[model samples]
Target: MEKVIILTGASRGIGRAAALMLAKENIVVMASRDINALIELKKEIGASGGKSEALPCDVAKENEVKKMIEDTIQKFGRIDVLINNAGFGIFKRADKFSLEEVENLFRVNLFGVFLCVKYTAPYMIEKKNGQIINISSVAGLNGFKGGSAYSATKFALNGYSESLREDLKEFGIAVSLVCPGGVNTGFGGAVADGKISRDFLLEPEDVARTIKYLVDESETANAKMIELKPRRRKEFR
Candidate 1:
């Protein structure tokens, strides 16, 4: 049977790249808030002789996430992989940013992943085999001056992924976290606009390829966490 993958944030950037790449092998179920972009991706995958289905969902909304998972199971029977690539970072010094903005960042970056896992894990446990890949960030490992809120969310994700790995290992459900340093996606653009250099950053396809590798490998090769950083770049203090 062909493996089924549910990829969040499939409307654009790394999520879109992962959906396209994974669809070449597994059945990709794309979920994101942008219905139009999902339609376009459905066409792209179909044209490339791959299986894909798009579902509109805002990952932060529990009801929407629940519905998306239900629809995916109905369409695909079972899901073998879940790529939680649905997150964004908003940079600002802690004092300079409002509390509401920080909450919004957390809602999407951290809480949404929690909701996805909450809704998807039962299905995976029933099958007794699956993979969960959470796309965190380098900021998650260590904080930067202007990344207070965003960094906090990612840090939460890191811990969450680790705890999940421990809890789900017995169920044959592997959990992994990708902590990339500088990907040339909307993140890079955000940092660039904030006056940080983004030269020679890793592209979205680079990260997507790593994700594809993780999902395609056998259960024995359980990769817990992986980090990717740009070459010859200054480290954030």
Candidate 2:
């Protein structure tokens, strides 16, 4: 049977790659704040003879999150997987970050994941079958200079995913976290500045393939957490 999947942050980077890959075999509902990008992706998926739907959503806002979930349910009848890939990063010294900036980051990165799960879990629980994949970072496992604020959110996400896994296990919903290191994306607005080299970073397709693995794995086997990093370390720093 084809699974109905809701993928947040579908506009770019890992989310975009995952949407394209998943849509080839399953129904993908692409959610992101960039409606135009989602539309373009939708068209691309259609061109390839894949199923997809584009939705404009800001995961940090509860109303928008609720509406997106509700709308997906209305359209699909059931959601077989929820990929919480909507996130961004703001790198700076801990003291350099403004309170509002920290708050906004947490809202989108941490609280937003919670909101999506909160609204979507009930359906999964009722069905006793679903998958939730949270896209995290290696920053969650290790700290770095100028990454205090961003690291903190990912660390919190790590802890959250751990507990969520335990909570949902009994309900038969699998919660998995994917922590990738140094992806060659425009994340944190760093790629354009030439601060990092694309040669050493993991491609978004790499992470997308990992996501496909988790989705295709047998129901009895739950990959609690998967960490992915580029084989060649980023030397530029």
Candidate 3:
């Protein structure tokens, strides 16, 4: 049987690319906030003879997340892999950004990951087999100017992923934290307040391949972290 995969933030960008690519090889249940985009994605994959389903979800909301997981379990029976890729970036200096906005950043990028992992882990543990891939950014591994809020959330994700990897390894669950540099996607459009480096950038498809690589690894090969950077040097944004 094909692996059962759950992915968040699947409406666009890296999440969307990952969902499409993975569906070619596995059964993918994609969650995202945009119902219309989800429909498009579902149709595209279904037309291609791939197995996929899209559900409307907002990872920042705990109740929504809970419902999504419950519904996923009801549909798929169990989750074999989870891709925590839902996130938002609010770029602004600490002085300019509101506390609410900063908190929103953390809610989606960090806390959202926590919520998804919390909901999905039990099923994986029960099966004694699974993989969790958290799509962190280079910002998680390194700091960037004007991105204090985004960086802070990603930094938290890095630490969370590290700790969880140790805790889950004993249960046959593999956790891989992906730290991608610049991926050409809606993320650039979302950066209304923060400026991203304009030099060479990684494509969302490339990052999706990284995610696929990690998820497809043999149960014996547990990759903890993988970082993707531009082939050319660019000043930090």
Candidate 4:
């Protein structure tokens, strides 16, 4: 059976790559705040003979998250996979971060994941089988100079995903976390201006492939968490 997958932040970066790859075999329901980009992605997927549906969703908002889940369930009858890849980073000194900045980061990076899972888990429980992949970062595992606010959210996400895995294990739902080191994308206010050396960064498709692997794994086994990093490390300023 073709799996029905819900991928957040499908407009760009890792989410976009995952959507494109997953749509080749599964029915991908793509959600992002950028409706224009989502529409364009939908068209591209269609042109490639892939199945996809694009929906405008700001995962930070509960109502929007709820509606996205409801819409997917109504259309597909069941969600086989939920990929929470919607997140951003504000890299700056810890003291430089304003309260609003911290709050906004948490809203999307941490709270947003919570809202999505809260609304989607019951359905998976009812079905007794599903997969939830939360996209995290290496900063979540180890702190950095300018990653205070950003790392906090991912750290929280790490803890949340661990507990969620335990909670859903009994019901046959697999909760996995993918933590990738600096990827070659426009994440964290970084511009993809082609100046940065690609050797030091992991490609979005690399993470996408890992996601596909997790999705294709046998039901009786769960990989739990997978961390990806570039082999070469170079300083890019």
Candidate 5:
């Protein structure tokens, strides 16, 4: 079947990698806030003989999120997958989080996932099949200090993805949560920390390949949640 996917956070990082990898076989709707970067990525995909279109949209806003899904449907006729990869984080002590920080983190990480799924789910249902992949984190599995806000969002995402998986199980729409450890995306609102080593970090392509593998599963198989970690610890030395 010809696949069409709406992938958020495609301006860079994991989203960008997934878009490039999946577009080789699927029609990709690249949605992100960085217009220039997305346009460039779209061109790169085109040059590679892959199909993709760039949409500059912020997942944090409901109106924009809705419009993004609508635009994808209008263009592609059906959305076969929704990859909720858009996210950010600010590391700090739990007590140090400002109200704005909490709201902002939730706005993009939790609420964004909800809104994207809300708007895109029905079309998947109508087709009687689809995939929703939520990019979570190991921090969500085990909380740590200075990760209060960031961990909360991913934890909530895991919870929601779990329930949504069962809710739509009968409808042929699969929801999957992927919790990866220590990706080298310069994510979490900071560049790769100097104290951190790449030995324990996953590359963006590794996670991208995971997303593709999950999306490619047959109807008889469902990988509900997957966790990817580096083969060796960075601090082993």
Candidate 6:
């Protein structure tokens, strides 16, 4: 049977690419705030003879997140995989940073991950098998000067993923985190402080492949955490 995958942030970038890649052989429920874009992606997947459903969801909202999970379960009967990829980041200095914006950022980046896992894990625990792949950033591993909010959220996500991995192990559920460095995704706009020298930029598809590998790995060899960075050069963005 084809696995049913719920992918958030499926409107663009890594999430979009991962949805397209997984839909080839899996039943994908694509969720994101961009309903229009999700529809377009679903159409493209249909053209390729892949199966998918476009479910508009704002991961930050608890009610909406609950509904998204319910809607997926109603349609697919079970969810075998969940890719938490919705996130937003902006460059801001500490002195000038907007606390309101930081709170909003954490809502989607950090809390979003928690909400998804909380709702999805119970079903996995019941089934005794599932895979959760969280898309984090290199910022989680190394802090940059201007990325106060984004870095903090990702750092929190990393810690959460580590603990979740251990907790799910006994239930036969695998949890993995994919941390990629400076992808070509245009969301990563400006770079200040330049602490993490972006000498090489990874492609969104590269991270997608890593996710697929983790999903396809043997059950015994649970791939816990994966970090991807392009081979270093002199300089990049």
Please give, for residues 91-178, the per-residue lDDT of candidate 1 as tens digits: 7768988888889888999899999999999999999999999999888999887888889999999999999999999999999999
Deviating ranges (above 4 Å) for candidate 6: 191-199, 234-237
**How does residue 31 of candidate 5 score in lDDT?**
94
Q: Estimate each model's TM-score.
A: 0.96, 0.96, 0.95, 0.95, 0.95, 0.93
Q: How many steric clashes does model 2 contain?
A: 0
lDDT string, candidate 6, 81-156, tens digits: 9999999887768677788988988999999989998999999999999999998988888887678888899999
Q: For candidate 3, lDDT tens digit of each residue in 164-233?
A: 9999998999999999887777673234323554457787898999999987899798988998876784
In angstroms, give how far residue 35 of model 5 lies from its true place: 1.3
The better candidate by TM-score, 2 or 5, is 2
Each candidate's lDDT (Cα)?
Answer: 0.88, 0.90, 0.87, 0.90, 0.88, 0.86
On TM-score, the candidate that comes out on top is: 2
Regions of model 4 farther than 4 Å from truth: 190-199, 234-237
**Candidate 5 residue-wise lDDT at 14:** 95
Show where candidate 5 strays beyond 4 Å.
234-237
Each candidate: RMSD to true structure? 1.5, 1.5, 1.7, 2.1, 1.8, 2.5
Candidate 5 residue-wise lDDT, 140-215, digit = tens: 8988767778989999999999899988989899899889887888675433555455666788999999999998
Tens-digit lDDT track of model 4 for 146-229: 778988999999999999999999999999999998798888643244444556788899999999999898999899889887
Instruction: Kindly give the stretch of ten consecutive residues in candidate 5 with the minimal lDDT sum.
Output: 188-197
lDDT of 2 at 172: 87
Q: How does candidate 2 score on lDDT?
A: 0.90
